[model samples]
Target: MLEHLDRMEAHLRELLEKEGGWLPFERFMHEALYAPGLGYYTAGSRKLATPTDSAGSSDFITAPELSPWFGATLSTPVADVLRDTNSLDVLEVGAGTGALAASLLPALAELGLPVNYYILEVSADLRERQQQTLAAWEPQVRWLDRLPERFRGCVLGNELLDAMPVRLFCWSQELEVLERGVVWHDHGWTWHDVPADSALSRIVRERMPPLPGYLSEVNLQAEGWMHGLGDWLEAGAALLIDYGFPQHEYYHPQRHRGTLMCHFRHQASDDPLKLVGLQDITAHIDFTAMADAAHASGLEVLGYTSQAAFLLDAGLLEHLQSLRESDAHAYVLQLNSVQKLIQESEMGELFKVLAVGREAAVPRGFRRDRLHSL
Candidate 1:
């Protein structure tokens, strides 16, 4: 692991030299997480696992891994989209460990809707793990290296947008904006602020207030992704689930430090330079911005709500009752996972679900949606 990290650092250093000793933070983060064979996700590492399975070996656990019910319940909305759009396919982006696919395929099959399942994954290591976990659904589940020219299906992205690279900016009372970049000095990587470029400056000025020393992130890449979705999604809906806030709450005056975070071995920190390519770096999403991007790209905002609300509307309690009647032992175990997924103190309130579609009906999961909030 040490040798691998060294090589990753060397690769970053070469990039810094090529960029004239200053590398934009967005580019640095992109390479740190996705660089050919050295970045955190690109390299060999045990990244996703449930707490019981991890034993302190993994960086973090996701909703799908925490409870199979997560995916099982999600199948409700997926089925709604499939029927509404008159399609028989599902596309998942950045499938971590294939846990969701494992559960979703069976659940969808139970609904008498056995359709083709596709996964778009960038990490070769994760693809291998997914293949092992989803072996039972072979030939039904296909992996893609990139987006298809035209797709007509329900798109799912769990905890996906946060991982995209973001542009970090600090605004001062004097109305000056500075962009954060990475630089090597004293044999270590550190932050170096430069005057914000015209594009970045315009974005910050338009989206944020000029407060004294307010730091925040802007996800231009995620906006571009929304545009890309508009290009190929001829007839279907895209469900995006992640932790985030609406624009007003996201850029609130009290949120001065921003939501940039780093995860390593199940521990959270604000330092990204410390781990180079070893830890996962992420930022909370601005849902309003995302909705705006989707609208600009000619997509309709179908729904927006908390994960808890969406899950409940999608029949979580009904699924729990069925499990209780079928197997007592499994029910007892899954009940605990259910609590963690829905309790407000856990992922329930913090995480949100946003649905954008074109020529598709609003999913039943959003029957109680809080789109007014966005």
Candidate 2:
């Protein structure tokens, strides 16, 4: 850990010297999270869950924590994809702690479908942890560094795109896409604001979704990744569960600051510049942009909705009933988990679920009636 910190410090110092004693926030973020052997994900002592945590350990929780039935619910729609494409394989990206995999794989096992599960994770430490947690099902699980050449199974990613480095831009009625650069002054690093550039400024002028618009975040990386993901699957579905807003909400004119955050030991912090590579850095996803990229890449956009709606359509309530009727105490625990996931004040509203594919017509897992599009 010490060595990693030293390496990161050197990198930061170098960045400070270049570009007139500063760096773009996106550059800082990339180096902080993904720099070889020195970034937060690459250097940490694994944050994944262990058997000791009762299948519920993490800095933050996800939908799968609600119940094993969450997997069973997801399978209902996934099974349809399999039937349509005549394939039962699955590709899961960024399977943190492998909790969802542990829950979903066993359920997929019993479905009697000829299945191959692939996990693509960038963190070596977390990959090792996933291997240990999922050792019992070696026959079904495979590790990958990147997406395969050709695939027909469902592609899954939860809270994955939000972590991709986003280029931050500040906008005004006159000036647009102002760069959020950092500069080293007398004592320490501070923000160095600059005028709008050619490419991003054009984006702000032509492509920006109707937003209130004082400042906003841009995830060009997310768009690029979605395009690649869509291109990889010959015929299948891509399921993404993440925290983000549609373009309209993302660029609300009154909104002066974008959603960029850092998490250290479950505590949320607004300062990404402080910790360097010690804390996790993330930004909110833009669902509209993701869908646009998928469409541009020849993938059909099926459905976009909130996590709550998707889970419910997939039968979260049914799972609750079955589990509750059998064991009241366990049912109560599961309900609590659902509360954190779907409550309007919680992740429910904050997290949006997007589904894209080639074979599936319109995914049945979302409450499509409620969606407002770009």
Candidate 3:
């Protein structure tokens, strides 16, 4: 890890020296995640995930680590999706540390839902580690490089859409989309406006309603991913859980710069260029655009709700009671996890949960009665 970091530092030094004193934020981000040797995710370094939590850990924490309650809540929806069917196959994208999978498998197992869990993880190191953590559930577990042609149960993703590469755009006063580009200028890396030539423009114009803003981020990759998921599902449903806002709030003129941030050792910062390949960069997902893509792909947007609402409807309290009555210490730990997930100031409000399904007999438990379709 240290060696790769050193090599990356040297490469960055050379690039900066030749071009300017700094690199564009995107370039820095690319190096951080995909750099050959020492970049955060791609590098041989152990920066992102490890056996134990230690100092200088990769930035950012997802709900899975917060508690088993989230997994319990997730199961309700999965079970609901698979209610009429006995055989269930779940494909989970980006199983960070495999926490959700670890918790969810047992929860569903208790519910008598025999599940074949398929984890599609991109990181080699994380995949190997996940194999060990999930070793006990051997017969039912299968690792995949991608989603299969047809699946019955559910395709679930948590905190995934935000990480997809996005195209930055600024809407001019004329309401035209202008592409944001990076250039080596003024002895440093700088941002400049360029003509929008990407195919994303057509989709954005057609699906994304006009917003009166010049500076914003566009996640074309996310839309593509949605289309792919819908196509691959072929039979079942897709559940996307991520931190984001509805269209109105996300594209409001007041936002100005859009949602983009970096996490380093649990500290959040604005400058993604500060520490290349050593931190996590993420943007808040735009749920509206995602739904639009799903609809276009022939998938019905079944429900969209806040994480809190989704969990409560899914019987979070029922699961909590069952655990609490079983053991006092375990109940306390579970409560702490629930608090992190449902509290107003935490992931509860910020994270939006959307479920898209095809030919489902009924709306899942998470979307049972009070679901608001967006």
Candidate 4:
């Protein structure tokens, strides 16, 4: 890992030197996560858990990694989309370690709906891990190197939008909007802000007007992902669940440091420049921006809600009830994990679920309909 990080730093330096000593944060993040084999996700770091998983063995555990019940609970809404759209395909983007797919496939099959599960993963290491994890269900599973020209049925991603490369814009007291960038400093990389560029400037000026000293993330990649889906998805919905807030709260006065976060060995910090390719860097999703992009692209906003509400409404408790009480060890474990899944103090409120669909009803978890918040 040290050697990998050394090489990665050199690579980043080369990128910086080539781009006139300043590279946009989004481009840097793209390289950090997807720079051939040197980037974090592409480098095959052990980012998931297993039976013998250590406390600091991985960067952080996602909801699906915490419990199969996460995916089992999700099957409810997915099944609804499947039945409603009368489609049989499900596309999962950025399928980390394939835990969700491994759990969701059998759950969906048992419900009399054997889905043609497609994973659009970029990491060769993770693809191999997913392959091993889902070996038993290979017949129903496949991989896609790129987004399909057209897609039907449900497209889903858990904690995905947050991972996409985002353009950062800062609204300062001077009423100037600047684009965030990176450059080399004293023995390390650091921030190098430049004048805001293009539509990003326009969007910040219009959407975040008069916000003195506000720093936040805006994911044009998320918007583009949804826009592409809107163009190709003849039916069904895009179900995206991640940790984020709507636009208003996202750019609030108190958030001067922005939402950028980096995870290393299960600990999260408010820095993205330190470890570079050794940790996972992300920003909270701006759901309002995403929803607006989807709407502009012709996709209808079906539903949006907190993860707790989505799971409860989608029958998480029912799935829990079906567990065997006789298996005290397994039952206790699941019980604890389920609490973390639903408890607001944990991932419950911090993470939210957004569903953008066509011909699909308000998704089960979002039956309460919180699009107004976005």
- Please give each candidate's TM-score: 0.98, 0.90, 0.86, 0.96
Q: Single out the weakest 10-residue window by summed lDDT for candidate 2.
A: 48-57
TM-score of 4: 0.96
lDDT of 1 by residue, 1-374 (tens): 78887898899999999999999999999998999888889887888876477476998889999999999999999999999888989999999899999989999999999789999998999999999999999989999999988999899999889989999999866879999999999989999989999999998888877887899999999989988899899999999999999998999999999999999989999998988788999999999999999989899999999999999999999998998999989999888889988899999999999999999989977877888988
Q: Indicate the worst ten consecutive residues by lDDT in candidate 4.
A: 324-333
Best candidate, lDDT:
1
Cα deviation at 357, candidate 2, in Å, is: 0.9
lDDT of 1: 0.92
Model 2 stretches astray by more than 4 angstroms: 1-6, 15-20, 46-58, 65-67, 172-176, 207-213
The digit string of per-residue lDDT tens for model 3 on 1-374 reads 45555676677667757765545444555666766656666554444433246756656667876676788778887887877443488889988778889889999999898798999887777788779889999798899996677777788899878877677776666767667655556443457666565564664565455565656677777888898777877667778899988777787667777888888787888766556667777889888889888989988887888888788888889888887788879888667658878888998889888888787654454544324434
lDDT of 4 by residue, 299-337 (tens): 898888999999999999888777755566777777888
Cα-based lDDT at residue 113, candidate 2: 66
1-374 per-residue lDDT for model 2 (tens digits) = 45666668788878678666768778888888888777877775544433235432344455664456666667766777777788878888988767778888776766676578899999887788779878988888999987798889788898889878888777645644577777766655677767757987777766554343466678888899999977688998988999888877777665557788887666779888776787788999888889989999999888888877787887778767877899999877666667777788987778887889997766667755345664
Query: Which residue pairs clash within candidate 4?
Result: 59-266, 310-365
Q: Which stretches of candidate 3 lie over 4 Å from their true place?
A: 1-6, 9-31, 44-56, 172-176, 185-188, 198-213, 365-373
Say which candidate scores most in TM-score.
1
